[model samples]
Structures are given as structure tokens and as C-alpha cells.
Target chain A: MDNTESIYEKSVVPNTMGTKSFNIDNLFLVAFFGGVIPMVVLGAKNAKWLNISKKLIYMLIIFGAALLVTKLVFVAMITSGSLDLDNTTLNISYRVGSVLLFIAFKLVLNKAFHQHMVVCGKMEALLKPALIWIVVGIVVEFVLVVAVSM
Target chain B: MCEEQYANDRKMIEHYFSMDRYEDARPIIENLLLSDPQDPETLYLMGVVYLSREQYTEARELVQEALRNGYNPEYAFFFIGLTYQEQKMYAEAEDAYLRSLEINPNQANVNAAYGYLMLLTGHDEKAIKLLDEAIRIDPDDSAVNDYVYRFYLAKNDGSNQAQYLQRTMEIARNEQEKLINIAVYHLVKEDTKTAEEYLRQLYLLDPTNKHVLEVLEEINRTNHMLFLPNRLIDKIGGPAVFYIGFIILVLVLTWADINSIAIVILALYLITAGYTWLAPLLYRLFVKGKI
Candidate 1:
């Protein structure tokens, strides 16, 4: 069938509803943009299907603290005039380190939290918004990286 | 009892493999191999596990071993084709898939695989034919239908793209694929209005679908479609032209006594605006020609 005919069919096609569609790709995309945090909070807020344990939160806190310390050290080094790295190099390293830290924190926390999941149902709806944000975030990040590197 | 145990082990392997627990399935395959290392079926299953993990080299080796050890050569060849496909060795994949097809002419997957390879190599006609055959072999198989639909989409078979995309959605297993396809269906149909709707629906379904978002962005940015400018001109052009012409007419009427001076002034205004601005505006208004 041609697109035009199909479009016509779409208009006339009767409603027989039951199935729900969830966008998995979008869920992944949103994760990149801090969309994952809110999404995970909502998904776990009920604690029915998946539980977010205190240990996972502690791990995240530790990761955040470590990241803060790293930044402080870098700043101290720059202020003390001890480190002799070029501005571009230092900035790139800082940016990349921040990204890596976040990735590591996420991976570790995800492993901790998702591993003990109770099989409740699909998580697509929860994840979709986050995924879109993630894609947008990645694109922006990529553009920034290219600009910065250049 | 031992035979039953062997069968149960194979079943367990199959179950784990299906669930994508390849690591869990590996031990079972190893146990089966312990009993009879030459077990063709076990070897084939092992090969499939590797294939699923995208371990192409090991998959090819194991599948070839399965064939040598007298497994279902049809499936073994098909798996070999799959491994080759993963490695992007299209010619080898084609040869392996064809060999499988020769053994089992009605095998849907072999035909589908071959059809996909044809698409990769730009053999559109052959790809469609093979995919059609796959669909013929398994009419109720949504995946095969999806392949056929996507094949048409790749060929840019305008109407067919819509039809198959719709069909693919109808039998689509997930809401996400269904939503994405609906937008795609409208998109291929040149029904941008509907396409954007579905694309938005797709975003609501799974917001991270960059492809859907990108397509939506593309559609949103492309407002100056060929018919749009003409329609816009039809709506406002008459009044605009009349008003502008009236001013010019008045200028000529009042300045006919100083015709040479009036003509020069008009020419100056036209030249100043025409090449630098009006021509570009008109070009944008009419064809939306872009660099």
C-alpha cells in the first residue's frame, strides 16, 4: 500500500484498544540528561517492582563526594600554581573526568539497584522521558566536546 | 534416564539462551559436550549462544563443527550466515544463506537473512523477492513482515513503505516500535501533519528515540514545502501585488512629466532591493532552494 492510502486508512481505522506502547530508546536517551534520576525515583517511589536500597544511596553519595574532592584538588592545584598543564588540556581533562565519574557512579548504582529487582512489569513509560533527555543531552555534549577539542 | 537427562539439559540450554542468559547456558552446553563432544546439536546450540553474544569467530567455528558432526546442516548454514552477517562479510553471508535455502527452500529465516544481505549489497529486487518469500512462508510472523516492510522502506517504495509499515505496526509486539512505525508510515506517505502527530506520539511513548525526534525536527524545519509557498502566495499575493503596483502606478502617473527621472528612481529601488533582498525572499517564498 502507498503512504497516501495508508494515511486514509489511518483516518478510518476503527479503534480496538488494549495494548500500550513504550519507547525504550527514549528511556535510554533521557538518562543522559539527569532525566534518569527523576525517572528512577518515580519508578522506585512505590517500591513495588524495584526497590532502591539505602546501600545504593550511600554508594551514590560516596561517588558524589569523591567527585567533589577530585574537583577541589584540581582547583587547588591550579590555584597553587603547582600543576603546569595547558588551559585547554586541563579543561578537557576536567570535562572528561567529570563525565567518567558520572558514568562510573551510574553504572555502579544501577548494578546495585537493578540486580535485586522484583519482576513487576514493564518500565518503558518510566524510562521514556529520561531517554529523550539523554539523547538531547548526548547531542549537546557531543557538540560541546567537538567545539572544545577544536 | 541418561537420554532424558541429555534432552532436559538441551531444553535448559534453549531456555537460558532464549532468556539471553548465555553465561548460564554455557555450562549446560559444556556438560552435554562432556557426554559426547561430537554432539552436533549441542555444538550448534553452543554456536548459537556465541552468535547471540556477537562472538562471530567462535560462532562460525562452532556452527561449522556442528555441520561437520552432522547436525541439521540447514540451520548450521543459517547460523554461519548470521555470523558472517554480524561480521559484515555480506558475500559470505549470502553464500551461506543460499546454501541453507537450497537445503530448505521454504525456510523463512534463511530467505529473510538472504533478503537482508541483498539489501546491504543494494540488490533491491532480489531483497524484496526473498523477503516476500519469507513472508509467504510465515504470514503470521510479524518479524518477517517487518523485514519486508523495512526492505520496501529502504527501496523508497513510497506507498508500499506506508502499507508495510502499517502492517508491521499492527502486528508489532511493543508500543514503541508501533509508535515509531506509525510516524514513519505517515512520513513516507508525505502526510507530514499525521507524521508529526505520530512522531510526537512516539516521543511520548519513548522520548529518547533520537531518530523519531530527528524526524520530527526535520519535518518541523521543512515548512516551506513546494505547495505551501504557492498556497501562501494565493492567500496574500493579490493584495500585496495590488498595493505595490498601485504605488508604482501613482508614481508613474504623477511623474510622467519627468519620466526619465521617475524611471531612474524606480530602477534604483528595484536594483537595490531586487538582487540583494527581494530575489532571495522570492526564492525562499517559491522554491525554498537551500545551500
Candidate 2:
């Protein structure tokens, strides 16, 4: 066979050949249920699978710090009575904050995630790791909110 | 069975499959499976037979077995995904497609199938990306082009929708295919009058086609004044437009401090939602005699 024909005939590894990573939808679900920390952790794991862990981890740290600052300001506003303690407002703000964080994480990871999917068609389920991270994340969030509020 | 006989049977099975004659291939595949149950190729062929018969569970199991016995893992998983998709078990289908893609990311059809799954599951963003990738890899594939066309149609992206539709038409294998695509394009655009005209031409060309008749009936049903809500929703590009309008109306009312008016608007929104849902069911029941 000619070189071109030989190359064409050779079987390359399928896109599912690498370490399993979570898709964007799963990341969104993790973020929704577990909050930002778990979402970041899971995203970091996916980044690791895609061999871009350092980039994602660094971006996430910056995002986390920014989020902390925002939370502190939010709490300060509530304490100073600039913002009301209406449960609906508080709930909406928290959910919206989580969603925004999810969007930010998705923006950072989108290209890498697409590349990974294009290169390796299969992904691992995020459920087990998400459950663990969610518990830890919720606990941390609860503690942080209480501590900051005080 | 002797090696020569086995080889001949394999060729015959492949030929039958190419001819889309699964029934003709089944007995030979079954005999081969009986002779050597561990034979991965025979197992995979049997899976194909089961798939054609719509015995999805059986098809899936046989393909899994084939994969276990060292059949092509990527193709096997792709087949498994197809079985799941056919049964509308989308989650399972996604997993199988992922596995298949993991093994062979270059498979244009798998990418398109996965993209369509994403679309069905409301992941429009992901669907767009996958469908685009599928088209990039194999632009000539009419099905992939059709999917891209459908995705753009849903997004109400007129230019991209028209581009893909034209591409699909360009690749049409025959006049029948071109006519159907034109009819569908008009139907989705809610130009039912134009759609009906094309369907009539298609009907004249292929009189026994049940799909053409059903669509013609649908057009007839939607012409009634009672079906105006359905036609309006289709023209305005789906229920999402109404939802956005409703949200804006509520926001405006709240901003104006018109609480009573807001309540009335909410009632109106609910009534609109109910009518949109009910009108189609009513049409099916009254016009088609089925829901």
C-alpha cells in the first residue's frame, strides 16, 4: 500500500481513550446542588483529565477570591441595613450567585472541555465525586456564611 | 463449520446487510453464533439483526458481548447507543455515544447523533457545538446537515437555517428528497399554504407515502380558526418567546406599582399557556381522531 493509503487504514485510538472527565451539564448540576466550591473542584478534575489542570486551578483560585470579596460586601450591606433580610431576596441572590459562578467556570473551561470531548468521546459520571464535594462544599459555605455574618 | 464455509457465510451476511435485508442474513448469523458463540464478528452481526428487529435489549447485550470478545469497541458502543436512542432511553444513549466517541472522536455520524441527543435533552449550546463538529468532519452527510438545519430552525437563526437547508438541497440524491426538504422547510416556517403545495407535488410523485398524507392532514387541521393559537406559537418561534414576553410584562407591572394589573396579566399568561398546550391535543383528537 502507498504511504497515504497505509496511514488512512491505520486505526487511531477513539476519542473515549483517555481519563474520564465530566461534561458541562454535569458540572452545572454539581454547581446547582453543591455550590461553587464543588463545581470548581469537579471542573478542576475535568481539567486534570484534559491535562489543563494548572490553568483551571489558577483561574478558579482567582474566581474564588473574587467571590469571597463579593460575599463579604453582600454580608456587610445586609449588616448595615443597606439591604433587607427578606428571605426571597436572600434566596434569589444566593441562587443567582451560584449560577453566575457556574457560568464563569464554564467560560474558563469551555474551550478545553470542547477539545477534550472532540479528542475523547466518553466521560465519567460526576455523581459520586459530586456528592462528596457537595457535602463538603455546603458545610464550608454554611460555616463561612455564619462566620462572616457574625 | 469449516473455515471456508465460515468465510463465505460472513461475506453473504455482509452482502445481505448492505442490501438492508436483515431477515435474509439472520439465519446464517445465528448458525455462525451457534457454531462459535465466542466469535466476536458473528456476535456483532447478530446484534445488528436484533437492532433491526427493534429488540433493543437483545441488541445491546449482544453488542456488549461482542465488545467483550474483542470486536471493535468503538463500533460496538456506537451500535449500543443507537439501540438506546431508538428506545428513547437518552441517558443510556448518551453514555454509549460517549464511549463510542471516546474510542473514535472522528465518527461524524456518532457526533451528529450525540448532538441530536443534546438537542432533545435541552442542551442547545452543546448540541450546536457537536453538530457543528459533525458537519466540519463530514459536510456531505445529508443527515448531519439536516440536524444543523433543525438546530438553527429552533434558534430562529434564519441565515444559518437557510444555509443548511440549501446545503441539504444541494446534496439531495433525487427529486423526491428535494421536494420533501422544501415541504419541511415551509412547514416549519409556518407557511402551511406553501408547505401544502409542495406536499401535493410530493404526493403525486409518491402516492403511497403515509408521512405526506399525515402532514397534509395536519395542515388541514391547523387551517381552522380554533388552531390559530398553535399557528401563532409556531410563527412566533415556539413557547419560549411567550415566556420571555410574560416575564417582561410582570416586571413592567411590578415597576409601575400596578399590583392589580399584574395579577390580571398573570392570569392572562396562565390562560395563554393552557391554550397553547390544549389546542394541539384538541386538534389531534377532533381532527385526527387520536391524541
Off by over 4 Å in 2: A1-150, B1-55, B172-180, B197-213, B223-291
Determine which window of 10 residues in candidate 2 chain A has minimal summed lDDT: A1-10
lDDT of 1 at B17: 64
What is the CA-based DockQ of model 1? Answer: 0.01
Give the CA lDDT, 0 to 100, for residue B154 in model 1.
48
Per-model TM against the reference:
0.42, 0.46
Candidate 1, B1-291: lDDT as tens digits: 287898888788878765446878988898888878998888888887787677999989997988998888888888887887777666667677767877777887677767766655545566667777788788767668777776665455567776887788788767767776776556655577898887787788666556677777667655444335433433553222322453466466555787677667667545543343243365566654553
Q: Which ten residues in a row have the lowest lDDT in candidate 1 chain B?
A: B237-246
Local distance difference test, each candidate: 0.58, 0.74
For model 1, how does the per-residue alpha-carbon lDDT over A1-150 read when each residue is reduced to its tens digit?
Answer: 232112111111122211122322222223323322333432233222232366765555555456445645655565567777655655444444444444443444342232222111134354455445456644654564454444
lDDT of 2 by residue, B234-282 (tens): 5774454455566678768888999899999999878876886587778
Question: How many collisions per candidate?
Answer: 19, 12
